[model samples]
Target: MLDLTKLAQQMQGMSQQLTLEATATRQRLELAEKLLSHAFSRQNKLTTHQQTWHDRLSFTAAEPVEPLNLRIAIPVPPAAHTVIATDGSQIAPSHHEIAYCYLINVGRIILHYGQNRLPLLDSLPEVFYRPEDLYISRQWGIRTEEWMGFRRTVSEAVVLGELGERIKDEGGGMRDEKRQNRETRNQRVEAVASFHPSSPIPHPPPHPSSPIPHPSLAMVDGSLIHWFLEPLPGEARDRILPPVLAAWDQLRTNRIPLVGYVSASRSGEMVNFLRLQACPYDTPDCMTHCSNQGDRSPCQVLDPLKDAALWATQLEPGQRSPLWRSSARILDLYGDHRIYFCYVHVGTEVARIEFPAWVAEDADLLDAALSLTLAQVQKGYGYPVALAEAHNQAVVRGGDRARFFALLEQQMIRAGLRNVGTSYKEARKRGSIA
Candidate 1:
C-alpha cells in the first residue's frame, strides 16, 4: 500500500548507513590486527636476544646478582618438621543485606610431619564484627575499603602471634595429662571465637607435642610484603603496623621462622631485573627502551612477559631460583624481618616463596624453611598441605553466609532492635512464584 518512490528512498538510506558502519568496522579491525601482530614481534626478539646481559642483570639490590638462567636444586627435606599455616577470608559489605558492615574470618592450622602426617592444634573461622572491626576510618588514608583486607591479614597474624605467646606461657611442655595420654602422636586443642551471640574467648589448652609448634616455620597464605605495603602515614601507620610486627616478634622469640607462599603471582620483579640486563648500556638505555620513539630493542619486547613465564622455562622440577631481596617500599618498615624471595618449581608451575631477611641471613634457617615447604608441595602435588588446610577452614560459603545473617536476624528480633530487612531484589531471588 506504500508509494513505490517512498519505499525506494527508505531502502537507499538504510543501505548507506550499513555501508558506512561496515567501512568503519573494517578499518578498525585491520588497525587492531596490525597492532596486535606488531606487539608479538618484540617477544620474538627477546627470545633471540644476546645472552650476555642475562649474566649481570641484578644491580639495584646489594646482594650478588644471580644469572637470569640460573637454577638450583631443592634441598632434601628434614625427616620431621612442623608447618603452621594461617589464612584469611572476608565478606565485603553487601547492599542486599541489613547492616553496613563486613566480616572477616581467619583460619590457622599446625601440622607435624615426623610420624603420621599428624596435625596438632588449629583455630578455625575466628569471626570479627566490631565497629572498629568493620570499617577503616577516613583518617587511615587508605582507600582499600577502610583497610578491611589489610585488617583481615593483621587479624590472622594476631591469632598466630597469640598462639606463639601461649606456647611461651606453657613452656612448650607435654607434662599435661591430656597430651601425655593421647594415643596419636599429634594431639589437638581446638578453640574458635565468636564475639557476637555472646561467646567468650577460650583459654589455650595444654600443649600437644605431635607437632611441636615452636622452632617451626610459621606459614602465611599470601605475600608478606604485599600486606605491609598499605599506605598509612603517621598515627594510622602506627596503629596497624604494631599487631603484625608483634606477631613477627613473638614468632621469632619462639624461634619460629616465617614463610609466605604465593601461588600464581603476577609480579614482574624478575622480568624488571632481566630488563636491566637487556638495556644497551645504562639507565638511559633502559629508559629509551620504554620510549615510543627509541630504537625498539629486545628489552622493549619483553615488557609484557611476567616473571613466572620467564622463570618457568628456565627452572626444572624441584629446582629454585637464587634468593633476592625484595625492592618493595614497604620492606623499609620491617626492621629485622626484611623480605627476600625465590621461586620453586613443582613440576607444574613456578611458585614464589618469600621469607624474612633474618631467615635468609642464616643459612640453616633458610634451608630448613625451603626444605619443609618443598616437602609439603611434594605431598600436595603442587600446593602446600598446611596452607590448603588453612584455606579450607577459612573459606566462607554462600549457604554459610545466609545462615549467619539468619542467626543475626533472630538475635536482633529477640533484643527488640529495629528490623533490618533485605532489598526487594533479594526477596524476589529468594522466592519467586513466576
Candidate 2:
C-alpha cells in the first residue's frame, strides 16, 4: 500500500502553502499594477505636449523599406541638447530580445522598446483620449477591439506556462503535464512558421558561431551615442550597428559624458558575512589581530575597503606599503562602478550618485548635475542630504577650527555654492546632529 493517508496530508499541506504564496504574489502584483496605472495616468496628461514636439521633428522612412527594415531620422535642431540612454534585454517564452531607448531633454522623457520589425510608430496612440491603450500595447502587443480576444489568450498562456514550470519542479499534476504538452506542440508550429521563407513574419537570424562585424557610422557633430548591444554573432554586427547608430542619432543632440558610482559594500550584515568568508587563515596572526578579526573574518580579496582601513592603522605616513596608498586603490578593487560617486560615512546609508562625467571638474556644472540627480534620488529613493561641506577638504594642523572654516568657505565660493544652508537645516530637522 502506498501510504495513502500520509500522502494526502502532505499534499494538503503543500497545497495550502502554495495557495498562501499565490495570494501574497497576487497582492504584490496588484500593488505594482496600481503604481504603474498611476504613473501612466499622470504621463497621459503630458502626452499631448510631448506628441506636439515629436510631430515637429521630421522622421522620414528610408526609401523602399524592405521587410524587417525600419529607419527613422529625426533632425537635431541647432542649440538642441539632450541625454539619451539605451539598453536591451531578452523577453521570455518567445525568447525575443527587446531594446529600450530612452530620450531625455530639458525634463522631457520618452521611452521606446520593441522588435525592429514592429516599429514604434505603428503602435503609437492614434487618439489622444486613449492613452492607456499605449501602455497596454507596449506590455501585451494588443490594443482596442483586438485586445478583447488576445488578452485572455496571452494571460492564459502566461499563467499556464508558470503553472507548468511549478509542476515540473514539484513533480505533480496531470493538468500541468497536458498544458505543457499543448504548449510544446504550439511552439513547434510557431517555430516552423517563423523559419518558413514564404511567411511574412521576420525572425532574428540564427546564432552565428563567429563574432558579428559591427558597422561604423559617421558621428553627427553635437551629438552623443550610448549604445548597449545584445550579444550577437560576428556575422550580424554589420546589420545591427547601423540601426543602433541611427536610433542614437534620432534620440539625442549632445555628447554627454557617462559616469557611474562604486560602493564598497551594501548591508552591514552582508559585509560582515562576506568578511568572515574572505578571511585568509584560521590561525590568529599579528596583522589579523590588528584588523579586529574575531570569530568570523571577512574575505580580504573581496573586501578591499576593510583591508585599506586595516592597513591604514598599521602603516606609517609616507610608507611604501601598497595597501595604505590611495583611496582609489580601495575603490578600484571592490567598488560597484554603476554610479558616479559613492558617499561613504560610518553608520549611514550609502549614497550612490550617478551623473555625466563632463560636470565633474567644473564646480558650477557639478552643482547643477548634483541638484538634478539629488532631486531624482530624493523623489525615488527618499534620501536627504546631511551636510553641505566643501567637496575639497583642507587639513589644518593642531585642529585649527578657524583655518578649517576659512578654507571651507573659500572652496564653497569657488564651487559657486548654493543650497548649503537649506541642506544643513533639513539635516538638523531630521535629527542628524553631526
Candidate 3:
C-alpha cells in the first residue's frame, strides 16, 4: 500500500521542483519562438538548407508546402453538410481468460447539419477465435495484442469507407432521379405545345424540389501516417497496409474529404524542423559536425518541445497553421494517398489535423476539412461531437469484459466441455477461492 504521509511529503518537494522547471520551460519557449520567427524571415534560405541536408538531418522534419508561419482564420463552414466519424475499441486476447479470443468493436457516427433529422449512431462488434485470426506469421514475432490493435485500425478505416460509399451512392441516386424527372416533364410539355413554328415554347421551370448536395467530411480518431509499418518487413507490412489503402481509395473515389483528428497532440515534427533551423553548421550534419558538442549543440536549445505546444503560442482559437507534408518513411508506400497535416487551435488545446494529399490539393475539400472541423469543435465545446460520440459508442468497459468471459464459460459448459478454466492469478484476482 502507498504511504499517505510519505507521499504527501514527496508531493511537496515534487511541486517545488515542477515550479522551477516551469520557469525554465518558459524561457526556453521564448528562445524557440525567436528561432521560429528567424526561420520564417529567411524562408527561402531555410527551405534550401533543408533540401540540401535532407538525408543528413538527425531527425525527421516535415516538408513545408506553404510558408511555415502562415496562419489561416477558420472560415464559415457550409450551412448544410454531413460529418461522419469512426472510433474503435478492442478486448485483447489474454492468457488468463477462460477462452483465448479477442473482440473488436467499431462505432460509427453520422451527423447532418441543417437537415432537421435524427443522427445515425451504431456500432459493429465482431469476435475472433479462429487460429488464423489470432495469429500472424510466427516468424515475424508480432504479438497478438499488437496485431489486434492493427486489425482494429484497419476495421475502422474500412467502416469509414463503407459509410462514405453509402452516402455517395444515395446522393448519386437522388441526382439521377431528378435529372430523369426533369427530362420526362420537358418531353411531355414539348409534345403538347401548340405555337408558331418560329416562336419558342416555354419549358417547365427548373425543378425546385431537388435537394442541394451538401459537402461531406469523414473523420477518424488518429493519425493516417502508418508510421508503425516502417520497422516491419515488406511482406509483413504489405499484409496490413493494402486494406487501409483500399479504404482510403474508396473515400477518394467518392470525393469525400477524410481527416484524422488528434487532440492535444504531442507530435514534435515541427519542433524538430525548428531545431533544424537552429543548427549552426553550414551542412547541418549532426554526426560529422556536432557529435563532439553533445549537450552544447545549438539545436539542443529547443529540446523537449512539441509541435502542438509551439503552435499553440502562435495560433488563435479557430486558426490553423500552414500545411506540411509528413516525411515519414512509410509514406513513400502511400503513393497518391500521401499524408499531409496542419495544426489547429480548438479553443481548449492545439490539435493536429491530418488528411490525404488529395484533400489538401483541392480548394473546396480543404475548406470543408478546416471549416467543418472548427464547427465540430465549437459544437462539442473543444472536440468534435461526432468523434466524441463515436468513442462513446466504441468504449468497452470492465463490466462488459467480465460479462463476455462469463458468457463464454457458460456456453462452453453447455457444449459438454467442462474443462473451461482460468489461471490461478485471474481466479484469485476475482476473489474466487477455488
lDDT of 3 by residue, 1-434 (tens): 58998789889899999999888878878988998888888777777777788677777888788997789998899788888889999998999888899999999888878844346688889999999888764558888888888889889999998877655544453456467775464544343233222343233322322322778889998788877888888887888899998998888877788999998787888888787778877777888887788888888887777888888899998899999888887898999999999999888999999999999999878998899988998999888999999999998999988888888899999999977989989889879555
Rank order by TM-score, top first? 3, 1, 2
Query: What TM-score should be assigned to candidate 3?
Result: 0.88
Q: Determine which window of 10 residues in candidate 3 has minimal summed lDDT.
A: 203-212
Tell me the tens digit of each residue's lDDT in model 2 across 39-100. Answer: 33443322332233322211111111111111112121212121112111111111111111
Q: What Cα-based lDDT does every candidate model obtain?
A: 0.64, 0.27, 0.82
Model 1 reaches what TM-score against the true structure?
0.71
Best by TM-score: 3
TM-score, cand. 2: 0.22
**What is residue 227's positional error in candidate 2, in angstroms?**
13
State the lDDT at 244 in candidate 1. 90
Which scores higher on TM-score, 1 or 3?
3
Task: Report the poorest 10 consecutive residues by lDDT, candidate 2.
Answer: 118-127
